[model samples]
Each structure stands twice: as structure tokens, then as C-alpha cells.
Target: MMTGGLSETKSATPEIQDMVDEVKPQFEKKSNEKYDTFEAIEYKTQVVAGIIYYVKVHLGGDQYVHLKILKPLPHTGEPVELLDYQTGKTKDDEVTYF
Candidate 1:
């Protein structure tokens, strides 16, 4: 089974860095800062070396490990406050769960 695993990374030390650098300027010039760069996106994964890297870009959504950008999933349609049920903790408890 393909459990939900999606990690983003930005490493240009070998070559991707160079490519990102080259591409970012053009992208920024075209998009006019509507979105951040891959570097700004905070890449949290790693890519290997000695193999042709296959990068898949998503316009407004994201990508999965299998290089598939699944269609937009439906929202829960429930108010977040409805889910904030704590027995004793108050809303001002100074803790925010992700």
C-alpha cells in the first residue's frame, strides 16, 4: 500500500541547485512572486546522484511519491471549532495542535 508520503527537498550542491538557481529567476520573472521557489518551499527530502532526475511540477497543488499529482481532494466541510473539543483544556491554553 502507498501510505501518504510526500516530502519536498531543495539540494543544489551537485546539480539540482544549479538548475533551481537557473530556473527560479525565470520563474519569478514570469510569475511575479505569486508563489515561492522550491528553495523557499522548504524541501525536506533528498534526491540521489548518478541518475537522471525526473522532476514533476504542480501548478497549484502538490505531487506524490509516485510522481502523480492527484486531483484536489474534497474538504471536510466541517468547522475547525467543531473539532476543538477538549475536556479540561481551555482555548487559551497556549497550545496549538497542527
Candidate 2:
């Protein structure tokens, strides 16, 4: 049986790091500050029309940045696209045990 869930990494791979580097300029432009490229707290890879890397980064001040990196298949040698970029503050929740 396979338990489907998000896989997390404390450290980033070269591919992920490269994607982050490429998108940093735009992210900084939009947010008016540099993104914390130190590490990725979590990530997921999805295979659709192409390969997609979903990464979550903590930018301090309760802010979290989510990035989606997409690459086309068949080796067209095209640049990867930052399909989606979003930021949100973390929320706290309480859990109850029964």
C-alpha cells in the first residue's frame, strides 16, 4: 500500500536550487525583498504535461512562499517557467483528541 502525502526536504537539490535562483529576481521584484534561498522546507514533484516542482519556502515574519517550477518534456531546451508564485502567512490551529 502506498500512503500518498507530501514529501518534505530540509535541503534542496541542485535542480531545485537552480530553479530558485532563476526565479529570485522576479520574486524580489514583487515582494520588494530578497527571498530566503537558504532552504526549502517542503516540496512535491508532479508529472503532468511536464514535470512540476512545488516548493515551499519560509521567508520569516510568518510568511511562506510557494513556488511552482515547470519544465517541458522531449528536451526542447526551453527555459523553465515559474508557473505559480504565492505568499501567505501561517495560521495556528488547535486539535482535539477523542
Candidate 3:
């Protein structure tokens, strides 16, 4: 019934920013650990039929993540490896965390 009330006036930007800031360090540390633990991984992907692409994540240690890479409709470019850490699995289409 009430539109743009006091509740709506209170912004979530700062709360989100603070939350991100608080967790950023922890996330960074964990990400660094993942990077350090897996250094011999490789990734491959190719765009097909517009925005969908076949993605292969080879985590080298012994695990992999395979998924259909897609962005929101009406974007551009195939799925590119923004951040890839591959482990060069012997078999194909399997992802494991080591």
C-alpha cells in the first residue's frame, strides 16, 4: 500500500559494501589458497549457438567441473576464461577439488 516508505528509503548499499569488505579478506585468502594448491590446471571453452558454450575445467589434481557456460541473453562474445585454474586431468569431463 505505502510506496517508497521509510523502510525503502534506507539504502542497502553501505550494508552490502560493509559486508563485502568484511568478507573480502577471507575470500581472498581462500582463493589464494586454491590457486596455490592447484597450479597445473588447464581450461577450455568454445561458444556455440549464441551465448551457450561448452566449458571444460580440468583441475589437474584429479577433479574437474564441466558446465554449460552462459551469460544473460543478448550479450556478446563466447565464454572466455576470466579466471581459470586447470589441473590437467587424465580423463575428460570430471572436476574434483584437490
Best by TM-score: 2
Model 1 over residues 1-98: C-alpha lDDT tens digits? 11333343433253444434444444445545544424321222222221122223323334211111122223644211111111222212322221
lDDT of 3 by residue, 9-66 (tens): 1122443333333433343364463422222122222333332222333334565433
Which ten contiguous residues of candidate 1 have the minimum total lDDT? Answer: 63-72
Q: How accurate is candidate 2 locally (lDDT)?
A: 0.61
Give lDDT: candidate 2, residue 21. 74
Each prediction's Cα RMSD? 16.6, 6.5, 17.6
Order of models, best lDDT first: 2, 3, 1
2 against 3, candidate with superior lDDT: 2
- Show pairs that collide, candidate 1: 8-43, 8-44, 9-43, 12-17
In model 3, how many backbone clashes occur?
A: 12
* TM-score for predicted model 1 compared with the true structure: 0.26
In order, the Cα lDDT scores of the candidates are 0.29, 0.61, 0.32
- Please give each candidate's TM-score: 0.26, 0.63, 0.28
Candidate 3 differs from the real structure by a C-alpha RMSD in angstroms, to one decimal, of: 17.6
